[model samples]
Target chain A: MFLQKKFKEYYSRAEIGMPRRFTRREYGFMFFERQMMLRHISFSSSQKLRNFLTEKAPAHVFYSSAYYSKPYEKEMKDKEWLGADLIFDLDADHLALPENCTYERMLGIVKNETKKLLDDFLIRDFGFDDLEVVFSGSRGYHIHIYDREVLELGSRERREIVDYVTGNGVSIELMLGKDNYAVPSVSEPGWYGRIGRAIGSYTDRILSMDDEERKKELKNVKGVGDVRAERIYEGLKRLKKEPRAVNALPKEFIEHLKDRVAIESSRGEADEPVTSDIHRLIRLPTSLHGKTGFLVKPLTLEEFDDFDPLQDAVVFGDEKVSVNVLKPFSIRIKDFSCNAEEGIVEMPEYAAVFACARGFCAEE
Target chain B: MQPTILAKYPFLPEAFDLVKDESMDEILHSPAFNRARELGVARVQRALKNEDSFLFIDERNCFDVVLSFFISKAIVSQMNDSFLLRRHAIFEAKNAYHYLEEESRETADAVARSLGIKRDRNGVSFVTFLKYSPNAYGQWKLANSRLSGGMVEVDDHTFLRLVQEAVRERVEGIKFSVDGLEKTLDLGPIRAELANRKVTHRADRVELESFPPCMKSIMAQIENSINVPHQGRFSLVAFLNGIGMKEEDIMKIMAPIPDFDDRMTRYQVEHITGKEYSTPSCDTMRTYSLCFEPDGLCARIKHPMQYYEYRLHVSSKKV
Candidate 1:
């Protein structure tokens, strides 16, 4: 009851950012207690959306990235889709991190993945500029491209984009050549260029390792015995210059290294389904996540480098609140740090809301 | 535009503009169009049979070529068979591609421009490339192809292939208002050609194991009494119907769900099956976000029915 009131109070005061073409997008809301979403709701203006947010105080708010001719239509077909902003969702849940990684570490890793997606794939490769990056408020980040060129892409084309970023169908033979030994210049475009650089870095890493480490790495590569590994190590610099120069070594060894570079050169690992789904409802910017009570905060590309979510996303003020912590938990939000075992505790209102929202604690 | 080129590529918008003034009455009943009608039937028959015989086109018979092309489209439109329409489109596009291969680069570029293929300094627009890249060879995917400066680079052949796809889409969308024209023309031969074109599914047995990964995932959810989404339910019902499953048997499969209202379920099943709603294509499934856990075979086929049939064929062949 306290958290819901606080959320309502926050919504009433907060000047939430409206998505572009506010009237054309469909809005969806999940209330405080309900898991089911009430969607197909359209707002004509910012004030209408603000009024609904203040009145109902939805736990989570979402708006369609797709523009619809009939935004309030009940049936999918009736809602004539005009176009959609291309979205790339980089969530921690999609990453294959260690089982016991800290929350902070997971965020940091996902943040790096998000950067690679934005900088390497979207910006450098795809040449998309009109981008909006938002902290998803719970697990990861969402990068939305509002470039006019990408707006009208169908799901098949979007799927092709997904395949490109995630390196789904990159053929090593094509990258190298028909003979599997045709060394490509590093200036080659796209995956070919990336894999070429990756080979150079792989060789550099192998040469920098101490004798035992270098030997261990080479021996681990299939069909590379101690003798072949020694020869390959001797010509490592040459192999870096010309990937095809290592053919004198075991073919399996060169093939293995090529395979390694192919995997390493894959651009980004954004969630596939999210990118491919043209009518996906992305989290509304500045809305509080139902699970974490943190703001789905939008950031400028410049602010993204220095922004810390735990501090900046914590919107609630620091009033003291009492809550029964169900388990031992340690969290840092804003300037307040809480390290408490299972018991009734007094903490800042923000921490209390965060804990209670995540089901880690309950109001006393 | 040259009339000869227009006749060769009659599906072009310019060709349509020229023919827009011709009356439907002249097209249907004019004894002067007897050669056009004959050639139209031959065009559709060749498409149905997948033959490589060319429509005789020359400077002298350019008018006949243009008229025959429009007459063939009108016949297909009157038939109202999507499958036949698609086959005709592919066949026409393939023919155009073969001709484009022999044509000069300037002519090809002109045709591309006519089809709205935007090209800048980099290459063709990424939108155009992606729009037509589906069902193309593996190397044609953006992941494998050369893309730079926000455009897809293509050589003369690949560019023509893309044009072919554009032409296919244009042909597929060709709907002529021939409601009365169908009564004027004797359409017995064309009707006979369409009788065997409807896809018939093998009804030997329900091979549960042969279900595509998407269907299998939905079946698993249903068997575990997990609530499947509306898209998943529709795809599952359509797929089961496509595989010749009886209404009662499909109902038994849905019985495990907690909220499975028998009457509502049966009604939906009948509506989907009794109406003969074929399985949603793989692309449609992907668009609706129902495609789950696509596997190796998924990449090779375009539809779930094709997946099941291919799997069944392979397994049966091995046995």
Candidate 2:
């Protein structure tokens, strides 16, 4: 009763109207409150949507993928889907970070990767004018592309986009010159461009370094042997000094150089399955996450760098609440860290919300 | 409170001349008002203005006009963020005409039917809008043969103009005859061009020179009674099925096997025929060590199916 009243009161303070869906059947999940099941629901207006949210008080508000012509229709297949947004889910779990890594570290990695995706791939490669980035609230980030040009892309095309973003299926043969002996420049489309740019930068980086550093860097390149490394240094110098450029290297030597570049350059790690899905329900921004008493926040790319989920995403203020804690917990939530023993804890309302939401404590 | 008409909702131009004109007939005829705008709203506006369901005497001209509007207004908002030109592509048309892969097939059909235009399932399709969106947000669009072998991102208005221009270019296709028979095209040049094109087919199996290099090599190996690998056998079966070869003929090709099992071979061939197992992709073939770089015919294409298609396309066989 208290949770419902509190949740409703908090929700009524909305300055802006409820975010409209392409379909009125708003999807949400409140897993810990009950057995979580994803089902379509209709709400006519913002008031009705608010009613559903507060009454159900779902831990998570998920936006459905199906934006139907007849949104009120019950069944998904029966509802004629007009179209949906192209969403890219970037999760912390997808990153190459160490196991048992902290949330902050994982978020940092996600930020770096997502920034690269936005700068290099989305805007530069695909040429999308409008790209939306949002925090997943729990794990990583979500990138939404709203361009009509891609509305009709089927599973095959979506898969190709994933392959491109992840740098998968990039061939070495395609990157190397066949008729003309020049590596495809950075201006080329897709991986050939990426590999070319990587090699150019790598060459510059190695040449700028001392002889020992140069040897170390070349050795680290996956396929470069000592002799090949020496040859590459020689070849790179000739590339810099001579008009013959990189063409002076033998075909076998070029092959090895290309392989080394491919190995060194390949590092696109987006969650593959998410981008390919045409109809995917994503967690709604600004909705409270039941798992951690934190708001599932949405941020622009500019706002993302300064915003920290642990501090900035908390909704509740500093009113204290007493709860019988089940387990000892040490978590940072907006400077009010809950380093409580396995007993009763008289902590702030923010921590209490997290503790109660996580089923870590019972409000007494 | 009255609802506000969202400015630039579809086509960015909020006030078109048709909407501004006080005279009813002038608005109805529309005086070729930015015929490039192809605003689907123009169709509704024209119908409302003309007070008739059909706009032009020739439905292709009308379709071209209406298709522009549907793209400009119905499909995308001029705010530069609506459905990609591929949003709910709904219809696909593929025949001979370059640039157009598909358009709003069902919508066009309904519009055509209403306007007394005959819609052919195949043949005689020109100035098509081919839009294939293959993933969640990745797509290929060819609406109106105006892309000049390249693609461009378009707002509703731009898309409308491009499609209208294409329709105008192929306006001769819009026959004015009573039954469309009198004004129908000769298609003699097109037919001659097709006849002169080199084509490989399952039906034309007797022409050994028309065979793709991979298939030809596989056949040679089969004839020499050399042991073919599992991957080679699979590729052969898939290739045969694709070319519409019969079960007996397919088995005959495989009969030269040193340790041939009749039941096993028959079942595999039957499976390929039934589409129980699809042909492996070029990548999968490479993984199986069955893919070989064959000279000629195979240079540009990746798959055996593509190679066969390429061969048939280049083949100068007559209809």
Model 1 C-alpha lDDT per residue in residues A1-364, reported as the tens digit of each score: 8778889999999989999998999999999888899999999889999999999999999999999999999876688888899999989988989989988889999999999888877877787879989999998999989999788876556877888887766776677677676556667777777777776678789878999999998888777888988988877767766667755555666566665665555568867778867788999999999789999999999988887899888899898998999988899887888798998999999999899998899888
List each candidate's DockQ score: 0.29, 0.04
Q: What is the C-alpha local distance difference test score of each model?
A: 0.80, 0.54
Output the lDDT of residue B110, model 2.
Answer: 34
Residue A347: error of model 1 in Å?
5.3
Residue A162 of model 2 has an lDDT of 65
Report the error of model 1 at residue A183, Å.
Answer: 3.2
Q: What's the distance in Å from true for residue B99, model 1? A: 2.2
Instruction: Give one digit per residue, the lDDT tens place, for model 1 in B1-319.
Output: 7888887789998887766787778877888777877777778888878886565567777777787788889888877765577778878888998888878877888887888876655678667887665342256767766676677777777788789888887887777646685666777877876775433433447899899999998999999999775557778988897786766788888877655656546755654554345677899789667789999999999999999989989898999
Best by DockQ: 1
Top candidate (TM-score)? 1
Candidate 1, residue B4: the lDDT equals 81
Interface-residue RMSD per candidate? Answer: 7.2, 12.7
Tell me the lDDT of model 1 at A349: 92
**Between which residue pairs do clashes occur in model 1?**
none
Worst 10 residues of 2 chain B by lDDT: B88-97
lDDT tens per residue, model 2, A52-93: 676667766776654656655565556555666677888877
Q: Considering summed lDDT, which 10 consecutive residues are worst modelled in model 1 chain A?
A: A257-266
